[model samples]
Target: MSTTRHELLTAFDLLLAPERFKDYGPNGLQVEGRTTIRKIVSGVTASRALIEAAIHADADAIFVHHGLFWRGQDGRVTGWMRQRLGLLLGDDVNLFAYHLPLDAHPELGNNAQLGLQLGLVAHAGSAGRFGEQEIGFLGAPEDGATFTSGKKLAAHVERVLKRPVTLIEGQRPIKNVAWCTGGAQGYFEAAIAAGADAFITGEISEPQAHYARETGVSFLACGHHATERYGAPAVAAHVAAQLGLAHEFIDIDNPA
Candidate 1:
């Protein structure tokens, strides 16, 4: 079964509501390909490897969290950019990407998925949003649960993500946690101000160590790619199921 590219994009727009976000890049379709899309390949990024893999899979469309164009990127499509674009253009495969929209969606977003993986729940009474455009989320363990210590929380996160986590231990137990996936260290201070016992994000900057020490709030830096790998595939799968199209999620590993 196949669906028109317009129908797929419309479904995504209705699901994500891209207009609600001021994202770093364009949200919906980036590169135009065949009007009829049968199979879609979803991944974390639109790197050369992912593009090649999609082409090999004979995908009619490529859906990703990270796409080729960004707000301040160079206009010239040369070097690596040229190669990636050439692959999609040559094969006439559609490229669809969603940035902040993918992160902020309450159900199928990166933050929500990461929280689910870690067994965190967004309570109704708490003010769940923080940071620019309220992209970050504040949540707690399910059913009034709390980690006995930061180390225990870190261990759980590491086990769930299947990767080593860089933890800045706090002076107190972790009860309420805040998180924003994918290079969201900048939101740490906001998380702290929002009264989070701990903050989790994809990357940590140099200053966050000191903040964690002084503020008594734990900090965890999971891998940027690791934290963001779920949203694109989840969104794609929903679209596929709705449109009766085939979908495959391809993970191109990146340790950073």
Candidate 2:
């Protein structure tokens, strides 16, 4: 089975609605490749390893959450950037990336997927939205379940992600929690304001430790790559099912 690049991009745009987001970079089809795409590869980031793997897999298109270009990066195509782009260009493989849209999507976004994996359920209705662009989510254990304490919650997260989680314990037991995956420590204050007992994100800054201690709100720093590895594959699976195209998820591991 095969689909045109235009069809694939249109499917993604409909699924993510990239225009609704004010993202740091463009959302769809970052690199143009062949007009016809039969097999697609998805990953968390478009690193050199992922590009090589996709090409080696004979993928016609590469779908990812992180792309080559960012808003403030120097516009020069050199160094690692040159090599990555060269590989994609040389093979004529389409590169599609979605940033904030991939984070904010209610059903398939990073936040939603991570929450699902951790067995957390979003608060009913509009209450889940928190932080800038309302990307952060406020939730709790599903089906009236509870974590009892910050340590318990941290353990659960670590178990689910299969990685060590940094925990700054709070004074109180954990009930309601807030989370935004992938370097979203900036949302901690907002999560606190929203009355979360604990806040979970990919990375924690220096100030969050003090804030967690002083404010008595738990903070957990799961790995950035681990938390964000779901959305791209989810989107790709949906697109593949819809378009009758073959899809594979290539995970290029990153410790950070």
Candidate 3:
């Protein structure tokens, strides 16, 4: 069955509540395509490959976490940008993207889903602030379960995410932990303030190493793409199921 673009967007907007966020990009319908959609494709980023893959898959709509437009980018439709836009426009494929909104959702957000993957029970709201938006999550192991040490936590992350985790070890025997899914190493200070024994994020900065050493909060960099693989797919599946459309999640892997 096909659903109108308006029906899909309204359902998603209500579900995600993007109005609550001050996002870097638009939360819905970045590009208009067909008015009705039967097949949808979802991915982490709206890269050229993913767009082309959507085209090949005969997807009427493409939903993603990282959209083409951003806060600081020039508003010109030229160069690589021109090509990407051309594909979407030429194919009449809808492009829907949600950046901070996708990251901030309590259940379907990247951080929350990652927490579930790692067996963490959400204990409190994220201490990390992005303007007024809380983009991270704070958690601990579920009752009667534990991750013995920082090394063990890192190993679990590596096993779950299927990527090599870079560990900056702190004090041993991790108990409380905090995490944000993508390129959020800067939130380590917030994690520390929240009394997290360990912090996990997608990317780490140079200064974060020293912060981890001095503050006794272990840091783990688990690759941005790897960390964010869950949210978009979850959102897509929900949207498709809600709108009675077929949804396929496409993984165009990126090492970064």
Candidate 4:
């Protein structure tokens, strides 16, 4: 089975709502490939390496969290940028990147999917002032299950990502927590201000270390790639289901 590029892009545009965000790169389609797609690949970034992998996999379309054409970027396509764009263009592969929009969706967004991974039910219409929706959320387990401590929560995260978690300073067991998807260390204040007991996000910058320590909040540094892979797959699965297109999610793993 196949779908036209225009048709697929239309479905995805409505699903992601790229207009809601001021993104670093072009949100929807970056490269126009074949008009019809039979297979789609999803990843965290359109890095040269990942793009190559998608090409090798014979993907017609690639979906990602970080796309090309970032904010404060040069208009000229040169060096790494030039090489990446060349690869996609030369191969006739279409690229679709979703940043904040993927992070904001209630059921299909990166933040929401991350929360669901850890058993969170997000509140409706709780997007922040930055138009950043809440990714981490508060929820009790379906069977009244519990995570005994910050250490335990960190351990669970480690188990899920298969990476060692960098535990930030915090105390006690937790059942109520909050989180955001992607590079959202800046949203820690939002989570804390929301009265959350703990917070989790994908990548953490240097300054966030001091912020977490001073705020008396526990932080966990799960690799960015590991944290974000879920949302796109979730979206792809739904899109494939909705439009009845054949979908295969290829994981081009990166230990970022």
Which candidate has the highest lDDT of all?
A: 2
Q: Candidate 4: misplaced stretches above 4 Å?
A: 123-143
TM-score attained by model 2? 0.99
TM-score of each: 0.98, 0.99, 0.95, 0.89
Best candidate (score: TM-score): 2
lDDT of each: 0.92, 0.93, 0.87, 0.75
Give me the runs in candidate 2 sitting further than 4 Å from their true place: none
Q: Estimate the lDDT of model 2.
A: 0.93
In model 1, how large is the Cα lDDT of residue 168? 95
1-256: candidate 4 lDDT, tens digit per residue: 8888888889989988888766666788878898888888887778998899889989889888788877788789899999998999999999988887887777887777776776666544443222244335544443455567668888888877788777785663565567766677777777766765667777788877776678766777777777888888888778877777766667777877
Cα deviation of 171, candidate 2, in Å: 1.2
Range of the 10 consecutive residues with the lowest summed lDDT in candidate 3: 124-133
Off by over 4 Å in 3: 124-132
In model 2, the clashing pairs are: none
What's the count of clashing pairs in each model shown? 0, 0, 0, 2
TM-score of 4: 0.89
Give the alpha carbon lDDT tens digit for every residue of 1-256 in model 3.
9999998888779888989887777789999999989999999999999999999999999999999998898999998899999999999999999888888788888877888888886674434332235676777787636567779889989999988999999875687788888888888887888778899999999999999899878999999999999999998898899878999999998999
Q: Is candidate 1 or candidate 3 better by TM-score?
A: 1
Candidate 3 lDDT score relative to the true structure:
0.87
Error of 1 at 175 (Å): 0.6
As for model 4, its CA RMSD to the true structure in angstroms is 2.5
25 in model 1: Cα distance from truth in Å?
Answer: 1.5
- Candidates by TM-score, descending order: 2, 1, 3, 4
